[model samples]
Target: MQDLELQAVESALTDLVDGERRWATTTLEQRRDLLTRMRELTGAHAQEWVDTAVQIKGLDPNSPLVGEEWMSGPYVMAASLGVLADTLDHLAKGRSPLADVKFHDVRDRVAVNVLPTSVYDELLLSGFSAEVWLRRGVSRAAAKAEAGLAQLDPSRTAGIGVVLGAGNIMSIAPLDVLYELIAHNRVVVLKLNPITDPLLPVFSKVLAPLIEVGAVRIVTGGAEVGGALVQHDLVNHVHMTGSARTHDAIVWGVGDEAVERKRAGDPKLTKPVTSELGGVSPTIVIPGRWSNADLKFQAQHVATQRLHNGGYNCVASQALIISSDWDQKDRFLAEVRNAIAAAPERAAYYPGSDDRVASALESYPNAERLGPGGGRLLVDDVRPDSAEPILSGEYFSPVYGVVEIPGTGASFTAAAARTANEVFAGTLGVNIIAAPASVKELGAAFDDLVEDLHYGTIAINAWTGVGYLTPTASWGAYPGHTIDDVQSGIGVVHNAWLMDGIERTVVRGPFRPAPRSVIRGELALSPKPPWFVNNKTAATTGKRLTEFAADPRASRLPGIFASALRG
Candidate 1:
């Protein structure tokens, strides 16, 4: 918005391009040092950042908002720093390398600088999922950068990189910027979403080094600012981690131009663009024989997926595609509604969430409202509804509705297969809550579901959001795309492993949980509940989770024992 800022951004891009030669030559050690400095600055200044996030956004430090603040708090901050360290350390020893991809004798990758902007204190109870992505992402970028340096195209002119950030999450912008720079070696000019612009001063403080290095800079404004940036002559590569609507507008270049472009096999602009647009994910509850414990654990798991982020995430379990005839289906739906109702009221992230919820009710007069306060949740008991039509609409509040349409003999399995084809939000994750018998009976069907589901990440008895948290999981829209058909996004993000993978990631966990439910106890937005397995004992559970994540298959017994013993 300022002339000086414009001048600085121009200068920054010029410097980055002028210094391209040194980019490949820049050692991983140097990059690591920059990341280290960023982590330290973020951790040290966590409180100020927290204060800024809270005050500027005027977000309540109660229930859901507090939990999100926790992501910015110490837990998230420390974890981000740790993962970053772990990633750098992985490269410090020269572990994995990927240099095969080349384009016109030019390397398109560079070391991405992950700026940790978490407020550690608030998130102490909750685990930081983004850390899982960032830590692994940095190392992957380093490896990519190493290979890119070898395939450098000295004559290739660098392109303008435009990044439009997400408003709900704190580190999304920084991480996206890091990816564009480190993953593709592109210089970046990031535009802050207006919703969180108040935190600019603090973010400016945290990202000073990126600005100082002339690799990244931030510009603040609204739609006009974004439109101008996208339209800028120097800008070439565009990236946004927000709404599908925005991506559509950007790809087609909003208005009459967009309409014209759609008519052809082209967009308003032909330039290469990438995005991490939201998804309307589904959680498939495969029916099978299970004890009460299995039902409880899986029900809670589904509830957590929808409840996280105040139920505003693109990947939130929008459609509970289940076998309507499964005997446990009604019970599962009941428990899920109860869990959602029991959940405390959350602050809606999207600006018009309240209106959206109200509109949804008005649109579907039959939708039943739940929770202590009716606004907390609304159960829209859906019956096919013209094959998953609710998914076409975006609901912001924690509404745990059921679509209990009939399934054939493999009621659950068959329903999952059917819904997988119909749901909106191309990016999705299938949550399978099943007993061992069910897994076996439906393993082949599950395999096909994995092959068939359009989701980006598939989780088992847990929220797909965990995939986003795991750091190693590749996050992106489903890959089969053409300009007009592009659903979720064009590329992937937070993939630390850098596996050129085609298979959808499946996160498998225990069927029935040990009493210590992380989400209910420590990770809850507020004080620990007495029944929360985590409330009575967090240390025991934390250690178990740590071990489980470190080594799952090999270390199953302890995990089982811990779960059985209630941690």
Candidate 2:
């Protein structure tokens, strides 16, 4: 992609900033109407958006697995836009969007229940729940102080911001734009990741209203375009969802010179920046006596977490922590391997997946290749202190490693959480799967487990992606990370509730997810969750799910179930 001329780039940014000034000053009523239009436009163009993504990614357009595109593409975008519009509508009526939200004190922090925004939300995403924990000393009155800030902030000035999008997830780029435009009230210029630029037209079309009003602009190019926009004077703030290497290159320079600059505490750009970079995420499995069926079910849960998006996700479970003392440990590992073997092999579609997988195999020759055509890797017997490839590496592929500590209950939980925080090199997301009995056994210590895990989002008996799908829950690395030791980069996004000073989000769900339930499962959640890369009806079912979410009706429920069953 050729970089646009400097003059043209500057002009576009100026136009966006001017439009953003108007956007920042809009009354709640006007802002609500604008977002309502955005939701409608996005829903209308949903199909084209998914289709383009499927085609560009070389997936079968007619296949149900195309649902991956729908969920990651139009579905997430439409869902997020709808949530933002609802927040604005509430604010226009002089009510806090989180007026009915529940909160409970946990030691020094307050955990705010941010899910189930409406009855429809609970009904649609059954059995799933989310809570956002505020940083210490942040009172209830100040919790959502910025929720009603459609008008200008007296302490802050309105200006244009730039978003450097991620190519792996279709929802990321547009969602980043939404965070800037709706939450922060900044006009935005979103530069598409060249790898996924084929969907640019679809994005432009869906965002036509915003484009016409000059509230947003869509740009296309590679590193040169990103550098120009990042260094431009008119851009007041910058947000990016990419790699830590990319973040360093953008903040410091590149090569040996950049390393020295970083060591000296000097950066190229002084403007404020926020980012969501990749990490080696972890999942902890508390030891407990379990029936074979329960073992089999949780194994599938762990497999789906790793194999989702071909393991391209930043939140994918890369490190699996278990207790060596558990009697069921061998059975669980066997079940995990069986599940991975039975699942269909997905193409290593991401740019570096093949090379990463190959490198991992060479480093750990004992690694077992699971699934058809060697599409998945399972490296077992990884000791807690071993310098294994999976321990320090972010494979970014359909690869997972298992580490066993010696203990049970609180001892195991503490060791696992500490290892996840200190050894993994990221505070992005972590998962904990424990039976109700096990949690009851630990009692108050369970709270300690939740508090000690230094991650932006934590999932209890669920995948971390569930937290990502919940809009009110903040999505980013944990706070207190610096540019010099930038693990998982920095900053938060997708916080539709307009909260500030967020520490982390915790989500809890049923450990067994009821039998034959639509939203829960041992083998799969519902009949077919599009996240399973092997789901044959993913495209159609995903499309149906998105439509139902966009405009929920009792009549649409049967069709969604039918489509899900077909896959």
Candidate 3:
């Protein structure tokens, strides 16, 4: 490494040495105060953060689609600050964060209701609910007993951690830093991805409280800096949000020797590492009778799943799974095509996006380029057993394919689940869309299907991204993956409840939007969610929601409701 780069890394480490000790013994009240200040600063700079991201991605500032940046960037950060502060408040009082939360038995496993914890959540995110399912053999009492940092031995001194930030979403790095500092009681040195290094000013300002206290440090560079930081003697733990290839390079040295070392179960870096590498996630659609409106609305929903962030998201739906026997399959497919074509156009800003899209086109000659500038590609009617790369690879672009299973009802759902598990690349998340009536018809079979799928986060009648946005829900790949095959990574973050032994998070939303939802007997009051790409008022709603998340009040409800209803 160059002298200056090496000095920078050394300085960061040296600064954090004392921080690691100071933070480990810091009182919970002090930590909560830092979070409160962080939240205030984040809200103050939220607009600037969103505007910077908008310019970086070449998005129109006037377009509603700027809401994507608002929601994914500052909104999530602000919400997470509040949630983590609440957890610390409970810990300061010597109580479990999940003390009053409801727990229920699902197939003999304990599932804790983590959402709607406050009246604000019920109003702001009505019709949405989330539950964190404990890993098998974890009883409810054990869950409460092990929740938060208080459970650790008081004299145990926390060490410094190195966090590798993600490029796609601006909030990911800061959120990971928060998790490391509060949840694990570790000081963090967060290295921003080169692609998002421009946001260093915004991050520094927003995270000033932590930085001033030496509890966190933000640095920028490519692999060389990250490599040096992770392997540094002072760093005791490592967390990253990126690809599996990158993770392997850091854990096992790169090249032929790296391959052999992985094979031999030996690693270059001996410190504990946790990551959130993405995979080729699937969107499974159950067969159901639907009105024309249902077909149109759901088509847009699926389109949003694939096209959000121009399909650069780690959890972006890459495979569309449907039952061949559904009579409306043709209509639904047509609607999806229309939705993809009609969605707003945006730049494919991520590195190598064009090449990934081109690779998909080369692999499937019949792929359709739907959006303007030919950036969106969709391959329909893909066979489950086909050797196509799009079916199993995480393209991380505006490219997706459809696979059809031969059955209906519970049999098709079961087969689809099996195919997703067997054929897909990673276990990060999966989305299942079923009408309320269709789910009712399946009865306990629906619950059984959910329990059987081995994904970190499962969404029924909603996008898994919702699970990511919910600060309390655990987000990561299903556990049991070893470093040799670290598919979609090995650990979870953003779990504000601070509960351990988490298997996965299950999130459910209304099958239909607002008025239509009520008419269809879903009884949900939520309108078209602001996160949807097609929501016209998303930018406004997202901004208002961020403000509310920072400083929640009854007075802010009217404006939020008004903007959301318009969307």
Backbone clashes, each candidate: 22, 5, 0
- lDDT string for model 3 (259-376, tens) is 8998888999889999999998999999999989989989999999999998989999998999889999999999999999999988889999999888888888888889798778
| Per-residue C-alpha lDDT of model 1 across residues 197-296, encoded as one tens digit per residue | 8767767766666666666768777776776677777777888877667777877877888878888867765678788776666666676665666566
Error of 3 at 141 (Å): 1.2
Query: What value of lDDT does candidate 1 attain over all alpha carbons?
Result: 0.57
Which portions of model 2 miss their true places by more than 4 Å? 1-8, 149-157, 516-537, 562-567
TM-score for all models, in order of appearance: 0.77, 0.93, 0.98
Ordered list by lDDT, greatest first: 3, 2, 1
State in Å the error of residue 245, model 2. 1.2
Q: Distance from true position, residue 109, model 2, in Å?
A: 1.8
Every candidate's lDDT: 0.57, 0.79, 0.89
Best by lDDT: 3
Model 3's number of clashes is: 0
Can you tell me which runs of candidate 3 are displaced by over 4 Å? 150-155
